[model samples]
Target: MDVEILARIQFAFTIAFHYIYPPLSIGLGLIMVFMEGMYIKTGNKQYEILTRFWLKIFAITFGIGVATGIIMEFEFGTNWAVYSRYVGDIFGSALAAEGLFAFGLESAFLGILLFGWNRVSPKVHFISTIGVFLGSMFSAVWIVVANSWQQTPAGYHIVGEGFNARAEVTDFWAMVFNPSSVDRIIHVWQGAFLAGAFLVLSVHAYYLLKERYVEISKKAFKIALGIATVISLTQLLSGHSSAEVVAENQPAKLAAMEGHYEESGSADLYLFGWVNDETQEVTGLKIPGGLSFMIDQDFEAPVTGLNAFPKEDRPGQVNAVFQFYHIMISIGMFLIGLTLYASYLWWKGRLFEKKWLLKIFAFSVLLPQIANQVGWFAAEMGRQPWIVYGHLRTNEGFSQEVSSNQILFSLILFLVVYAILFLLFIYSVNKKIKHGPYDEAKNPDEFLKYVS
Candidate 1:
């Protein structure tokens, strides 16, 4: 194997493993805000109880997110030194904003939210929760700005000083917006909300079946489920808009996602298919002229395909991209349908009581999160060959100084560490849930038993 290719694969694997927690942090951050708001408004002990419960889960997730994210940034300067140098100016600005604006706010306010439970007034604590919520969303904004710039490559002029591409900002606002940021950000926020919402619903359903914390989990579920319903339905528009942007800006990636091997007008979207590389065609059911409408927003518009690019420049593994895209869309649609059904049942006052629906709800909770990961994988992997589409190829980004053996060694170490972390998180969360929140007790006996 080419050492560089292997390094890229290793980096991708480790980073993908690392990505699992950030969404949870982002999602649960919003959940924390809602839970605290309910506590303040209703003075309901159950809301406070649920807040502490979910906070335990959020603490574990947020810690992991911080730990793993640092490694990804570190790898940029270590394994992908060339890539780091190439987009340093652009990446630097976004990273700096994240540290200055988001990270500091979150870390500081999170302390108050966690440790100030009895130390501070309820109003002050509530405000702290709001602070961290905004900080978490701000973090997503900055991170998305950096990635979106890579996607559409804006506000930069090349300073051709070395083998690495040097990008300096030409327009700060343009860099922030790029071409895909708004749509991508909407989708991202919706996905994070979906994660938090389903988590609440899943846990609530489990508790209802077990007859544990039924009242507490139900209130939490109502807040989460209602928001999830709205976000899941609206996410479709964000997905569609982002797809249109991708089709225009990165036709090669779009073509790969659909397994469109040959240039054609009135292209049909393949719902499921396998691409024959030799024959350059996807064998699947397709809607006539659908691809044209999707890409160009015009049914008759010409939709470019892989053949439009040089054979060497086309994305490899067309079938994989197509399959990933299909899976992502299927799961997303399922979430939309599931949320609508849940909403209807919720109105009918049968959501928690119906055994069949509860079972399905429990299972379906895993899908949105699974779909989120798959959707992200499709977006990133579909953009393969080009690390910064049309500007830099992935092959050009590796550091010659880093050996494959060293990377492999580190990768294995991470697996063991992360495994331990995962176990600890689950154990602690379950412990908290089984024991119930410390504040659930009204009398002295209840408070004393769980407090310390």
Candidate 2:
């Protein structure tokens, strides 16, 4: 196989697997804060128990996310030597900011939030949990800002000889607010919220099915479901706005998504289909004028079709974009449906009473995960052929000095290392969850200054 293809596959494989943890951790970080916050506000033992239970899971995900992410950093140097040399100056700054803004805050407070539970006062512990939550989110902001620059290069000028087009940050703030930043950030944050929310609901649902921690799990399910509903809805809106940006800035991608070919009135949106370049149309269910309306806010608006772009400029990986987009929308819709149903059950005071639904929820907690993964695939794959959008192609991003053999070796090494880390993470998390908080080595106030 070709080296570029191997590099792409290797990066995507590792990143996709690694991606699961960060969002889960980010989302769970919020849940940790909320649960602990509730315990503080209400002085409720149930909320405290809930906080203890989920914290184990949070730790598991955080460890895996960090471990997996470290590989990507190395891969940038090993696999994409050329690409790194070109964009390193600009990219390095964002990574550094992430360390400062996100990692700094999270790591600083994490000690207090975790091991300090009994070592500090309730109020102090609660504050530490909140810090962890903010730090996780802050980390997200800098990371997204960096990725945003790749999608829509800004605050930078292209320089250097014909061999490499070096990207340098011209205006720091402008780089942060690239044209696609808001839409991408909102969508990403919402997805993280859903991941966290669904995880809470799913685990609680499992306990509900077993009739364990009945009242407490019920409370968690209601809170998580409610949050999931709101964020899922907002995700839909953000997706719409994001698509609009793609339409204006990356029309070829939009055309590939819609399977539009030939200049036609009122572009149609394919619900599900296979776009055959040879036949020049999608073979499946489609919505007439939906494409045009989505893109231009008018049913009769003109949309550039795939025919308009030369083969070289056209987004080559159309099939992946089409499938991933469909999966993303479908999953988002399902989340809305599930959240609404859960809300109704909660309102009726019959949420946990419905064991069948709880069983479904037990397995469905991973759905947002699927949507999150596919949505990400669509976003990244949709930008195909370009590492820095219009500025440079991905093939051109590699370092001439790097060898495929080295990348292959690193890829194998990454797989082995990640496998071991993941197993340990799962073991530690399950062990902690199973142990429960009913009995602890010390009092909950051991770290807390609270005197009861």
Candidate 3:
């Protein structure tokens, strides 16, 4: 009802909507690079066709990612002026690096990747594909570094006083390589890869079911499956490593994540549970002391719980944090199981023969997206009451002059615009999938027209 709630909702809505596209772009970029590289390696026309088909999809995602992202920059100044000013010195450098090192490289090679297909040599074009992929990855690095720094503030010192106080970087590299940055970055990259790989698998699985582009779809599906399998396993490791980081640096957040209430007690890993904060109880299945073993290799090790922290400093939405975190973990484990089963079926030489498995693959694309979204929701919400860890309270960060009515109006406007953009994206991608990959053997002139 007030500016704080309205402003948080507005920014969260805008950022969450914007978040959907970047992972897709980053993930899709990796897939495109692999597809184009395969084309070059074998001089296979089918690989080229696959590369070209996905390139169109990649372009759509990249364009929308850029457009939706611009709004968040403006929102920083308009809705969170104090927060922006506080972190300006830190974010300014990171964003500048992204523009200089990441966006520039991706944008430069994009022309060669899209329009210079026939004009450039095959090797040169493949290089361009790698360039674009690396660029997207580097962009992710800077963004993650900036955000991770907020979660675990480092290399910064306070300046000024009260409302005038701000953080200025004391050590640039220390800030860049903040305690949580590397773990978070790796986790983010794996999530993005899963998002992209599942999308490719889903689309190709559909084509196979329809008996359209059967041979090409088989190749694409196999490649995506392999990627998905490897990333799913590594993602599990990354998640564990990230949890360790949280256990050490953000005990309150970790406490909230598992609904642990005792001041110094062994924490149980919940397979699934409902946290009733009123009575400080959790109901549902759990591995007793599993969390303690995971954190310290001891079943009875005492993990600092929410009771150890001041009530005002603890996360208010404990149930939401616990639920979001468990949902992410559940989806992650399911993906690992799904990809491994699909891999086993492929090894048995009956991958495509199982129509039921193919049907699951066709719909599995939503899982990774859901996991990425909820994983973020848990992380952000768990860090509640603080905009910059222990440094600044969230309530103290918003623009003082902004009104609830103004934020509400803009939020409504954003919802309308984003809905339209989402529709446009779905329609465009659907049309491309229906048309299928272009067949150079069947229509030589059409291929020529495409390259020209």
Which predicted model would earn the best lDDT?
Answer: 3
Backbone clash count for every predicted candidate, in the order shown: 0, 10, 0
TM-score of each: 0.94, 0.94, 0.97
Model 1 residue 395 CA deviation (Å) reads 0.5
Q: Candidate 3's residue-wise lDDT over 263-336, tens digit each?
A: 99999999999999999999989999999999999999999999999998999999999999999999999999
If ranked by lDDT, best first, what sequence of candidates would result? 3, 2, 1
lDDT of 3: 0.92
lDDT of each: 0.80, 0.80, 0.92
Error (Å) of candidate 1 at residue 105 is 1.4
Q: Write the per-residue lDDT of candidate 1 for residues 86-160, one digit (tens) a residue.
A: 889999999899999998899889999888888999899989888888888889998988988888999889987
What tens digits encode model 2's per-residue C-alpha lDDT throughout 150-227? 888889877785666588888988888889887888888889988998878877777777766566677787778878
- The window of 10 residues in a row where model 2 has the poorest summed lDDT is 443-452
Q: Give the number of colliding residue pairs in candidate 3.
A: 0
Off by over 4 Å in 1: 161-164, 438-452
